[model samples]
Target: MRYLFLLFMLFTFQLNAQVVADDFEGFGTIYSWYGDDCIVDANFLNPYQQGINVSNTVLEYHDIGGQYANVQFDIDTTYDLTMNNSFSLNVYVPSSGLTGSEINQISLKLQDKNIEFPWMTQSEIVKPIVLDQWQTITFDFENDFYINLDSNSLPPIERTDFNRVVIQVNGENNDDEVLAYLDDVLYFDTVSNNPIYDNLVWFDEFDGNGPVDASKWFKQTQLIAGDSWANGELQHYTNRQDNSFLDNGSLKIVAKGETYNDQDVTKDYTSARLNSKFAFQYGRVEVRAKLPSIAGTWPAIWLLGKNINEDGGYWDAAGFGNTSWPLCGEIDIMEPNVAKNQILATWHWDNGSGYQINSNSVPSTNANTSQNWHIYTLEWSEDTMKIYMDDTLVNQMDSVNPFNQEYYILLNVAMGGSLGGDIQPGFNQDAMEIDYVRVYQETPLSVQHFEKNKVSFYPNPVQNKLHIDTHQFANTNTKVQITDLSGRIISKKQYAENGDTLIYNTSALNVGVYFMTLSFDNGINQTFKFIKQ
Candidate 1:
């Protein structure tokens, strides 16, 4: 028994030590590939311009807006991707002209040639995508790949029989004929037990005195012109610090029961509502706030689309009803009804009926643990909203619907209204204390390359021709936009590619200081100042 255990340990170590590398360094010798509506040749390019021989020839997919284009690899032997825990890929996608729908529009799949058609494991491209430059996309097989089997009399596509690998563009993006490329596909066996997001794009620490950072937040103080801000809420939101202010290192939204007037209306309650100046469509949001324990207090951390058209014109001058409530979706991350001891996570949309909402309610905390600091989180991705309290998932909503669009964050406190309940006699002022609000965007691409190759643009104070040497293949994404010092775009030009050098003519330009921004397919943009004298 002791020798058996020792042998097993040795076998496990040997398995984990194995690594795979298929860089496609050779030209169709040991391994080969093919494309369908996609042309998979690195040598043949349309219109025939000089092409660069990148250290390595990547898998080129010339997708001409067809049903789809896929790359099938010739694996010498059966491949088992599940055996390895992680893999890395080099990919590029042009950022310009891409809609929110095209963000995660890349995917991977595999098939066992021994089985019939569709006998494969294809995963949804849930991974994040950055555009216009080269970036490494890492996949943790334990989470990114799997095979779902259905009823079949024949044996399913066993993991050991997956002899063909397919790389595809998730046929959803509206790209006319994008020239996509892939390089250095490598695999490893270490399973990562960490979160996918490692980048912080925006956040509010709520630190110091005075008003909140104007660059990060904006307070909403106006009442809806003809109507109050929906719900029978009694709070007259104000822009004053008395209602919303920074106390110590936290934010305080005080709900007071007193007569106050704002925007041609009077109310018996006054509070504050703040909106983030920036809007985001997807990411992780975490807010640590202490709810008001006062019987009449209601606090909420939520979001709403920025375009909630409320200018009285049903349409734009000509009258067509552009947009309004519900069409502009609302996401209520957490609304703690102190009086009811329940937390509500509701999603509201407009299907022509003022509002249509789906909600879930859960105990804010254990009876004894009430009125304490709790971490409320909203893990929002492309099409899902997962609400959590202190790390426990309380509610989840599917269907992206309105959430697929960009929306801004809002924090507010209300008193003695619909959900706030009856106010106790002599209700003074109670506050919702917020430790911090942090927003993290999806990033952390797979194993990245640290090559120091510089993509140069020259003719600093040019009069006519400008030259650029991009060590990458020149696709439709290779272009430059020249903007004036005042930030107005002067002209945008596509480069004439010849090997690794791209030539742009700036001969017809006014003489002045200008900025030239070079954009690529893999989320890379380089800007340089130039003089057009």
Candidate 2:
């Protein structure tokens, strides 16, 4: 009976897989729906509950005489207008509750939320609303007439940059009062079959003790500007092992309240900054780390464009520097402001005219960032970039021109910068501990295809040794990692100059399900699930 019920549930889910952006009755996929220059109650009781759509709760939008009043929301994923170009909503406007002589119409606008002024590059569709009646309105961007606020902007169907939705009852820039109710807001789209990024391109497990791997990282100690670093930071970065080291299978970046001198200058604090030797374009970066507990410590795991013309940088020293930043772009995956108890993810770039930035912050109290280990991730693609904390989406933005190139990773802990407020009077030292940093990119073949066509392993349910055949991957280094079902790493081994077959011992593992991932240096990976019995 249980199996039969599971099969029936799967069948029902497949039949109704259409994406519902939001519905006031509760199953809304978007959570950040809010108001701009207006007052809104997303879970208000239906005032006039007698119509074809008599839902219990609906979105109450009250434009209390504010100019440019509207209700807006941002989604973690952009609307792929190529496949789903239509949106439908049910709206009700009471003529008695309105005081404006404006036209009785509702406008649906799609915008790129990362820009300074989103409406400047927006695509909009206006529909007339009937007073004292609930009307169902549909805006079909592919078929209906749409107006692009920016004449140079592409058509809605040809763009993947619309991640924000704005609904306004009347025209903007007027002190007109309006009262409206909205329900069943949805964007229809077929089930997506997009490719998954499972191939491991690059990683640093930070194994062993002492200094970091020189081949994979460069300690950046050079002071920027004349006396201090950017953002009024008080730390003087040093190359010494005391500030940065590996211990007990983790990387520790220590920040100390001590007077240090570098480049003929002295500072009251010292820390370490490490730049990754490897650089890549679009991919997924995951870092499992714990932040510092000190009130003034600012720990960051970020990325910078490889072409940044900063002095003493790894890429700049290698003669790849040309553009100055923010022209070169910056992506801050995770930066904790200890004083404010918030974690920020920001993007900086040159928007042709000047420097532009888009940022989002999450309260650290919810995640206990300084007291617990969390996985911070940045999923980057040609269309969008999404930041995640412990697998929960925190911020997302559409990709711009500056983010289409290669970027290198950076790990540092700064003291008392612009974001990191005042330090504790008795502050001594604190450290940010990192377990691992891994980068994954998409491969030509899927996981099933790669495992079936290129590699093979025997004894799916084995008691001890398991043998893997890798004749297709010769004369290259491969990293093998084994983990339990809970994603806890069990063991890791490196095979350099390996032969056709490799043996992995599983005698120590208890009887359970485990996963083994084979990561090749040539930017490919395959995972196999097996039983240890």
Candidate 3:
């Protein structure tokens, strides 16, 4: 049943959306990739295949002490950055292959390849890299900090002259020898013209000052392991009002430096962990939150599969427990590493072999999460899942296997965990305040009804033919049109004198969602949605 649903989703939503700029797999839209003052092997075999990227082929860049060593690709058409401004790539830089003491960093620059001197007008975003492992990094011109080589140049989103992407390792002008492996270079515009998720289904506004709504949230206070939680966290999650409560119209999950004992275990710090009672298949989740800034604090807004066989989870208590941890899937919408001042979004699942994770990290929008409130969003659909920070896309991955199942939400703050290194001395208390959490799903298609005209249609999920009856207004001239979800017209016709029935041959239409409209000469129009199977 699940596999059939997955196939249905793929057939219904698959459209011509070009997001992968290059992956070196013979399927990328871009065909012109070259190097500037460097050596590039476009069809090199993968040397390290254990980490995030494990493709058979990759792009190997070797900068043998060139002054301006980089790899670049050019497109024939200039990009409208205001619409499509997000780009990402997976990079692996090994310390054994590097020669100089330059900082370990990768920079992605956008330039006008047609210009005589592209470097003078280039805009670049630099990200620090790890030495031995593969890491996926995103460059969001609309969100990340960028530098324009020419001071007089406008911001990346305001310009429309970018036709080339240049990727450089370490500082370019220095005589530093660096070797890096790159794959899955992607570019996309997060905005959707025909959004499926538009109807709000569930929400929590944290209205009054008191305990959280019992019917909507469950406090998971039971200890999972022997004496501590997973990941070496020092916090004992409790249901006490001091730990989780509503104050001043906001939900506050507080962590304090106090000795707490629960379930025969004692911890020096205490916090709250909440599991939303609601579980959903696929939808859009929006959370407006202000994070805790203490060095030892790890605050997260995440989701876990409803079938996860966790003892203390809300869904588990409700008899939906079966699958294990990574196989059940995990989606981390927002997790803040306070020490690094960065926000990480990740997806974990089993890819028929072992645990696989796809992740991306971006610097906090304001460099201080506690000082500002930001809206973190997760847009999940049949084909893809996207995570956004204040409307700027930070991460995107294909929807597969475990992600097709239902999942519930989890919000918590842990202290001194694996990701959170050490506790700050004399830290008393800190709170993560959340304004609201809202979930939205796609609106179902309405029943076709035209009262005055008395129009009707058959074969909604049409394969090759559609039949419509419009004999009630026989004397009136009407126009019929069919369009795709993006408002691109597909077919149009005019009926001079209305007949008893009209037939449309839809064999040429693609297998996706489309709209059909009927417009009469009397200024009356009606539209209905249909699917071409």
Best candidate per TM-score, number?
A: 3
Q: What TM-score number comes out for model 1?
A: 0.47
lDDT of 1 by residue, 372-417 (tens): 7788888776535778777655666554577787777889887766
Ranking by TM-score: 3, 2, 1
Which portions of model 1 show Cα errors greater than 4 Å? 1-195, 225-227, 310-322, 351-355, 367-370, 444-533
The number of clashing residue pairs in each candidate reads 11, 0, 0
Model 3 weakest lDDT span, ten residues long: 1-10
lDDT of each: 0.61, 0.79, 0.80
| Candidate 1 Cα lDDT to native | 0.61
- Model 1, residue 277: distance off in Å is 0.3
Which candidate achieves the best lDDT against the true structure? 3
1 or 2, greater by lDDT:
2
The residue-level lDDT of candidate 2 at 407 comes to: 99
* RMSD, candidate 3, Å: 11.1
How well does candidate 1 match the true structure, expressed as C-alpha RMSD?
17.3
lDDT of 3 by residue, 1-533 (tens): 01111111101112354333566665466677799988999889989874546566789999999999999998877876665667877899989989979878899999997889998999998877778998777787865657788968988999989988999999777998999999867675433222467789999999989999999999998887777788989999999999999999999999999988788878899999999999998889999999988889889999999999888888998999999989999999999765757899999999576887878877785657788889999998765788988865667776888899899999999999777779999889998999999999876641122223455666655668877666544687778888665546889988776565667789998665556777778886655545565
TM agreement with the true structure for every prediction: 0.47, 0.56, 0.61
Clashing pairs in 2: none
